[model samples]
Target: MRLWLAIIVGKICAFASRFFKRGGGSSLPGSLARRIEPHILIRLLEKATPALTSVIITGSNGKTTTARMVAEVLKHSGLRIVWNRSGANMVNGIISALIEKCSIRGRLCADVAVLEVDEANLRHVVADIKPGVILVTNCFRDQLDRYGEVDTTLALIRMALKDAPPGSTLLLNADDPLVASLASGSRCKTMFYGIESLDLTSGYTQDRNTVTDMNANMNMGMNTNMDASDMNASNINASEYLPHDARSCPNCGAYYEYSLITYGHLGKYRCPRCLSSRPAPDFPALNVVAQGAHGFTFAVGFEHDSEYDSIGASLGLPGLYNVYNCLAAIACCLLLGIPKMIIEEGIAKSSSAFGRMETIQIGDRSVLLALVKNPVGFNEVIRTIASEGSNKTLIVCLNDNFADGRDVSWVWDVDMERLSRNPSFIRSIVASGTRAEDIALRLKYAGINQEKICIEPDLDRALELGLRKLAPGETLYVLPTYTAMLEIREHVRRRSHVREFWRA
Candidate 1:
């Protein structure tokens, strides 16, 4: 009775949301259903999945992209896919998605459901749904207002794993020591995936020497700016590469020593005190045969056959972070028994997600959407844009909306100095969204000249001004947080006459 009642009420709300032209139809209905029936989500999962395989992906970054990649690959594999493609990922959203796919009598037709869950919501969602596969994309300091500390976030995820139903395979990011540590205590099977060799020159570099800061002001911005020192790690004040807030050994609390430095605190590192280290990846991205703005090509650690082993799979996205997401998806599909050729085909043909490195073309004007939610993610995106070596316009949107975590201090951690250092890389910058002025102030502090920066808090006008400022052959890069991306992406979609995000 509860399931049926919740479904009917939720379905009515979802229909009303669409008819009212509300952007995301999943949330209102889902939230209502959950409030109406506390166990509605769990019952929906059981109803949908006795005949279907369910995959849950959660992490600070890359959940949407990674989930999207897996969903597309599964579709190509000929499974009737039913997923929350619009990124509505709470337990409530999961129920609503299942409610849509299941019949009024509660029969399901889908073969798989790829659910992208939010970091904080993982514990609740996993408690209700025992997914066949749970993929943890590398965890980083994200939305401090909501997550508090990354370790706290990790602890929550760890509990989720501990409580996860038995026989579930935990797919993890082997390159991330923090993520790898989840395996130390969890009683679950684990599969790992990571980049074998990162092309740092593409947009970032690793610190080659040892740097220690026992009094490090640890936070999400642990690796904010470590590129200005001529002296190596021998000097206490020397510039250090920052990333992965837990620079000290997780086991012994001693400083981690580096073997190879990649962006942030990722790459090869071993604890000198406890001898803890990064785990070996099962599906390693090997041999970077090709790399650049368009994408990259690499070989997998293992293959279905000898002929398939040497095949160069390409991740059709920019930056090492995106490559990491692609690796996660590849590892996931392989575990799910997807054909290598089909996975490769999907990867090669994969387009950008709604905001992450999305490009919008309006006749001759092109706007690139590189969504930036946290300091770490934002830094990577900035590095990618600066490395392009092209003079472009920048539209940066910073929102303190509920969905955007309500804290805007992360703008300070972004190395806006990258653009300031280049001087010529960003022809002009327009700051938009609720926290536009704060971001503009951040740019100024980074040494960007005030004359080159424009403050337009209104998103619509900011979009117009940004496009008007775009010169021929030059691009406009729209870098926004989650809420900012939603608003900007919607405006661009309407103006471009393209379909809405969920419709696709």
Candidate 2:
């Protein structure tokens, strides 16, 4: 009786959400439905199926993008999938997605479920929906106010995996040391994917410096001796540093040696003391090509030679970080028996998931909104901008909202100095939002000319001022934290002639 009532109420809320755009019901009706009757909702869905195959993608950055890719790949394989395209990763969002798709008879119609869940909410969602496969993209410091540190976020994922069903596959980023470390001692089959191309540089000097520090800290903590070979392998070559080597053994306080460093100590590494290194990958990415904004080119590495053999594919998103994301998604999809052609087609046609790399046209100019809440994410955004050949303007908005964390100190860690070097390409810098002054000061300290920097606390005024400076045929790159992105989106929506198309 309660279950029926909950489903009926959920339908009402889902209907209401359509009208009340401001309320979360429209965006996250599942969360509200779960709150109203948790057992009823779960029971209602469970009654329809005895077993389920579910795939969950979680990480600090790229969860939405990876989730979208995974869903696309699965769809290409002819499996019906229910996914949350919105940037909703919480429990309510998951519930809402389910509610939106489920029939009034309470049966889940999809063949599989691919969800991009929040790192913090993984444990809650996993307990309620023990998925068949879990893909962990990478762990970085994000939402410091909500998640104290990267390790805390990692710990949550570890807990969630513990609840996963047996025979479940764990797809992870072998390039990210933190993610690789979590796969240790897992009972599930683990598959890893990362960049194997040696031609790609680690990035700017600041990026190299940060990687060195992370490696050194990892080495020091493990009391490992860094031999000459290790040093040579870890040193930066062609602007980017070496592939990430394991710094320490997660089981023991012993230094790990690395055969290569992918990015920020995320390559193949083995603890000399414990003899533990990255387990051999069941699937890896090969024949890589970094396609700037058009996406990536690579072949999926698999363990078996079946009719659906490995084939090349292209992604539709921008930036190198997304290449890593695509690899992670491909790894999981391969494990699920998704054919190579489908995976390629899905990636080639797929777009970013919401603000990950959403582009909007404001008046005559194009505004690319990239979300940067952490050092790694911000660094990637900076690198993407530097790689673009055209002269562009940057509007960086920082906020200390509860979601963004009060500690704006991470700004210093971000290599804002890179933007300073390419002054000619940067037409102007507009620093705005609650932390507008802080962003301006950081840019100034990084060597951006004071004459070109503008600080506007009011977003509307800032957008107006920033857009005025952009010449015709030029695009404005707007990078903001979470809250700032929402506000910016709202502001963009207010413009009468502009149309906002949410990324899938």
Candidate 3:
């Protein structure tokens, strides 16, 4: 009776939310449903068990995009999918999604359910979902105010893994040391995905300093027989001096040493004392055959593959981060026994999920929506913007709401100086959101032209300012925090007559 009542009430709330135009109300309905029946999600999953393949994508970054890619791959294989696509990653939000898709009788109609779950909500979700496949993208210092430190975030994921079904497949990022560490204690079967080398530098654009740091690290690590072509270390513009999440080895407590340092703390790491190192990837991008404006050409070799396969896929998105996202999705598809050709085709056809480099047109100008929630993510966005040579304007929105992380100090950690490195790369900078001044001041400190820095706390006004500055052929990069991304994307969607993501 409680389960039925919860479902009925949740359905009504969902309907009323859309009717009253009070936003999606994704969590409210689920929250109410949970209150009525504490174990509603578990009960719902039980009803779908044995038939539905539950998959959860969790980590500090790339959850949404990776989940979307998994859905697309599964869909291409002719599997029906029910997923939470609206950036709602919490337990209630996920429950809300299930309520909308599953029959009110509490039975699933789809072959699979792909959920992008929040890191903090891991234990709660795992108790209910017990996903057959869990993909941990990468762990970074994100939402420090909420998670405290990198280890805390990692610990949350480790805890969640406890609830995943035994013998479940864990597709992890081998490049991320922290992400890879989850495999150590797993009762689950684990496969890893990572890149070996690249033909070009990482991010939207390459700063000389970033490139220098990467090459220096690569050169440092090149001392061994590890093939440079196999490592492709020079292809990324990684910062060695930046605050790394893994400074020392978790196993040995020795200074974390690296043979190759990819973007952030991801790369070939080894602890001298314990002989700990990056495990050999099950699926490794052995060589970057080519890197162009279109997409990446990777020589991918699976541990079990007869030989390396060179696949060239064009990206509808930008940034090196997307390249990593592609690798992660391909790994997931491969594990599900999706045919190699199908995986390749699906990745090539994949679009940027929602606001992560989601582009929309506001009149004649193109607005590129990129979500940046942490310094690591934001720095990559800046690099991407710098990659575009000229005729680009930026509108960055920073919100200090609880959802966006109460502490706004992470903005300072973003190396905004990359934006000003190429004078023609950015023409105007508009800072918006509740903390518009803070973001604007951060940019000014990064060396963007003081006169070019504009501020409008109002979303509508900010949109107007940003669009007015763009030329007919130029692009405006709209970078926003979690909450801000949704708000800004909605505003752009309305003006551009595009479907809201939930509707899309």
Candidate 4:
């Protein structure tokens, strides 16, 4: 009776929220419903969705995009997907998504529930909702104040996986040692997906000393005027590297040697001390080619196997990060018996999730909004920007909100030197958010001239300043933290005829 009442109240609240246009209303109703019934999520899932195939995606980075990709593919395959499309990925948010999709009598209409669970909240959610498939996209150092280090984040996920449903298929990133290591303890059926070849030509040096030097530069901050030669940026792709983020073998304390590098700590790596190496991926994205900010194309699967033959796939979303997301989605869909053609169509059709490289056109000007919360992810965004080759107008938004992570120090670890490789290419930069001045200082240190950089803490004013500085028809790239992304996106939506992120 309490559960039914909670469902009724939740449905009413959801209707009111949508009618009033009160944000996305993705989590508030679930919070209220949960309050009415403490075990609302578990009770509702069991009573409502008995045969539902639940896909739980949890990782430090790429969870939202990966989950979105999976949901899109499943939708293309004719399954009704209920996902937290608004990026409200918490305990309450997951419940709210379910409640929003469920009928007044608490009957969920969806065939599959693709959920991107926050790293910390995984344990809380999985303790109740037994997922059919669990995908861990890649583990990177994120939200230092909240998640501490990558190991802490890994430990949290590991604990949650332990509580996951028995016999659940674990779709892991074979390239990410941290993610691959999760399969060691678990008895669940595990399958891996990764890039077989990234086709990186320039600055491709995959050696131990190169990693050591990069880590040294990261530990001891690089000089403000540090040129390309000082950090060996040209020889080894220092900008793509993430210091000591994923060097050490998860099994042993020894450093890893990479045979090939695929941006950050993801690549073919082996530990000399323990002989722990990258697991052979089942769904390998071979011959990967980057198409810059426009996106990339890769052939998935190997040519040898007839049943699992290679098929070409392309993603419209920018960054190799999205490629990883694509691979995870493809792997999950394939495992669920979806046809390769359907997967390709879904991959090609998948749109950016809110601020994950979402491009908005305001009259003649094109605005690209991307969310950057950590060093590795920020470096990839920087890489995508540098790849454009054309002159750039950038608005970097840095917030210290709790959701955006309180410690704004992670900005220091970003490869600003790489972004400033061709300083003349960057026409202007507006540092905006709560820590606008901090990012302005960061850019200044990274060799950006003070004349070209402006500090506007208010997002509205920042957007105005950035758009004003932007030339007509040129792309205005706005890199924002989580909260900053939401704020700036809302501001953009009002100015233009853009749909709400959840609907988009």
| Tens-digit lDDT string for candidate 2 (1-504) | 655566677878877765565534534567556666877535644864645578888987788888888887787778877877676777777777777777776777787888878888888777566677888888777666687766688888898788776677888887776788777767787777776653343332234433244445445432222222212325412123122223456689687666655454566677778786676665666766655435557676676565435657676665667777888887777778776677778787777766777778876777888898877778778877787564668899998887678888778767676676656866788999899999999988877789889999888788888788888867888898888987886776676333333222
Candidate 4, 1-504: lDDT as tens digits: 898889888888888988898878889999999999999988878865558888898888888888888888889889988998878899989999998888877788988899999999999988687888999988888888887888899999999888887768999999889999999888688989988977544332222233234434333333122346334654544444445577777677777777765667787888878998999998899888766447678888943336558778887876777888888888888877778899889888988776787888999988888889888888778877776555788999999999998989888888786656675778899999999999999988777778988999999999998888777878889999998988898888887889877677
Worst-scoring 10-residue span by lDDT in model 2: 236-245
Across residues 401-439, which tens digit of lDDT does each residue of candidate 1 receive? Answer: 988889888777665766776667778899999999998
* Global Cα lDDT for candidate 1: 0.76
Ranking by lDDT: 4, 3, 1, 2
For each candidate in turn, give its C-alpha RMSD to the true structure in angstroms: 3.9, 5.3, 5.2, 3.6
- Give the TM-score (vs. native) of candidate 4: 0.92
Question: Candidate 3, residues 1-504: lDDT per residue as tens digits?
Answer: 888899999999989998897777768889899999999888888887457778889998888898898888898889888888877899899999888877878987788899999998988887667677898999988889988999999998998887777858998898888899999887888888887766564333443333233434333532222112222435422243354677677887776666565567777777778887888887788655335444556656663466655444455566667777877877777777778887777877788888777778777778888899998888877766665467578899999999999999988777675676566767888999999999999888766778889999987789889888877977888899999987887788778987767776
Q: What value of lDDT does candidate 4 attain over all alpha carbons? A: 0.81
Clashing pairs in 4: none
TM-score of each: 0.91, 0.86, 0.90, 0.92
Candidate models: Cα lDDT each: 0.76, 0.71, 0.78, 0.81
Model 3 per-residue lDDT at 222 = 24
Ranking by TM-score: 4, 1, 3, 2
Which predicted model would earn the best TM-score?
A: 4
* Model 3 ranges off by over 4 Å: 201-204, 207-241, 303-314
Task: Give stretches of model 4 more than 4 Å off.
Answer: 201-241, 302-306
